[model samples]
Target: MKLLKSKWNFACLLVSVIWLASVNAVALDARKVEVRGLFKNAAILQVNGQQRMLKVGQTSPEGIKLIAADSKQAEIEIDGKRTVLSLSKKIAATFSEAALGEARIPAGRNGHYFTTGMINNQSVKLLVDTGASSIALNSIVAKQLGIDYLTSPRYVGVATASGTTRGYRVTLREVTVGGITLNNVIAVVTEGEFPRDILLGNTFLSELDMKVESGVLILQAKY
Candidate 1:
């Protein structure tokens, strides 16, 4: 009976030591990272070249949890199946307009200029409208740009194809077409029933030195 009791005690100690070592290993393996607002609910966390999905309310087997604070980036797990969620103050800054798209005037109709690129990470078609006083995005275009039109602040008395209509005025953090990037762009968000997608109005054009000749609009970035 004494020998059996000794064996049992040794086994329990071994198991406890092993469990603690496993926990420590997991802690040491976790990597800190920053998450952008692009990810919601379920996001694949990439750390040290490895990727893992972070589900809300669930801690990684290693014991990490992911919580979203805002559009800015946040810290996340890097390695191992489970880890602890650690917030890092060091996060990647949002992209500037120049960093978002390339610049080049593409072919278009009616002597108007066209540029193709991503707006809010989605493909968009923009028409250069010098006549327009500000950038105008149709209802559909605003949705595509991920602007929460309904909750957006109201700006009354905007003219549209349907005549003067209620609209929302918002500043796009960045607008990039071709190699040009425009920041703090004023965009008019029309009501649900709008006709066009997006019209690049003078709000953007006026910022540049442009000349229209032979059906082509030349734009020069002004200092």
Candidate 2:
């Protein structure tokens, strides 16, 4: 009788352990699913769905790759699944150009002319000038942009290399680059002869998140 009772007790214990393990496994799976959903949402926000066609395919090392069929959409591969994703047009257009290297800003060197990007739907080219105390513009550029330099307060000073220059304290109504824009930017208009057309100075550099890594100057607006 005792032997039979002991055997029954052992069987019940094993069953209980198995049931508890199954419950724990289900809980872990639920957590993983929730995390994946959150990540997808975040990616979607950064890049709109309309611009890209998302597809899945089997690949080496990893089981599958999620690719953007259209160049207008940024291509990303999802490993281990076959799926079709429809994204918003805005996201697709933004990524497609990026993937094609159309909108990429090439790495700039010191004393080189580089595009400052778009501002108020206008493309502005900036010359890298470390010596200028503030962002300086030539009379021609100021006039071309319809900036009334004569109306603003005048500041007379000598430039670092150019002798005896006259400047003005003018606020740029809008300055933009790389899809980023800044309002009321402080700038100086120097009358001195500049080797470059426009000078990108500390005034603009200070307002950006700048880093020089591996001989590349990466600048991003702080806003």
Candidate 3:
């Protein structure tokens, strides 16, 4: 698969733009806090095996207050201290929390902002594309992620560097990069291999505040 910069008719409008970008992984204390699931402005947290759903700014009976949340992680305040937590992982020691709702990506060796992130809890490489209207990937990548794209009801034609091709429109359960995450993201899966890199389109970027400084791409949650 070769890199191509072209417009997409379905959900992507990728243009010829380069961003020089990078994320530090964070771990939380598992015994005290365990994130069961994450969603927009809300999270399912299990404190001592008692699961409770908490919305932003709402405190649970266990004294855990949801501050901010995305598909990747949830920020909760306990005892007047805030820390982010992700899915089940045994963090034997306490870890530092990232900036509230913020993530930074540094450019790769190719001068493009490439980062490793999760699509439906499966890890994949992402190439940031502001021009694209929605996240885009090829069928191969979709299959690798266990996405049943062929069963989708929505099918559309997408414009790519090669030409227009058949694609499927689907909603991703979660898309995450660093500390920033979003859910129900729109994406297109093309039939053939073209977009060698998974294009992190506006469907995800529009939900965040983005800016570039000193060749680093910064993304922060809008909420």
Candidate 4:
């Protein structure tokens, strides 16, 4: 894989972004939050394991200040930059430089790319999807991770190839792929069955810069 910007460029800004293990990883990486659902003036965001209902111009406890919003999308300021986030799309401020550099994913037999990642600290397979809003997996995957979604109030109906389905919205404690580890990542649980590999959606991919060349998918941190 090739570096988009010079390696020296990353070297220059590396000192400012390491998380070094802390609950405050949410603070250090404020962009891990995802715009799950939106409404007029207010929005539902998942920051790590907590869901926040914030209004336009209101900042959450973790420093996510809503900039603008309507039924379709939202604009917010994080880490000193303004970003317009669409419903289900995740917009992050940045990622750790040390834990967020390059990766090369070779094409699979089916012509798609596959890679290994850790979800909520457990190993799993990931299929990169630039189109999905958040990380998506089946209920069976959630059960293996010890998540009980039935009692959780954040259930929603999803449209799938099989038809309309029920799923739960939950926050993942941590998701690490290659060298990057992100906290407060948002994901969906497709109640019973879903695709075999988890869909590594925008919630995680949006934090990086990626390119496809020679059947190899290259990913790099965009801080």
Index of the highest-TM-score prediction: 3
lDDT of 4 by residue, 1-223 (tens): 2585667678666644453344477557855677654555655566775656565777877788888876567788886888887655232212111122554566778988776666765556689888889899998888888876677679788888788899888888888665466788888889767755799999988988888766767787786
Report backbone clashes per prediction: 12, 16, 5, 1
User: Per-residue lDDT for 219 in model 3?
Assistant: 85
lDDT of each: 0.56, 0.49, 0.74, 0.71
| Residue 6, candidate 2: alpha-carbon lDDT | 100
Q: Sorted on lDDT, highest at the top, how do the candidates line up?
A: 3, 4, 1, 2
- Model 3 residue 98 CA deviation (Å) reads 4.0
TM-score of each: 0.50, 0.48, 0.56, 0.53
Between prediction 2 and prediction 3, which has the larger lDDT? 3
TM-score computed on alpha carbons, candidate 3: 0.56
Better of 2 and 4 by TM-score: 4
Q: Is candidate 2 or candidate 3 better by TM-score?
A: 3
Name model 1 segments beyond 4 Å from true: 1-107
Q: Model 2, poorest ten-residue lDDT window?
A: 32-41
The runs of at least 3 residues in candidate 3 whose Cα sits more than 4 Å from the true structure, single-residue gaps closed, are 1-97
Please give the lDDT score at residue 56 for candidate 4: 70
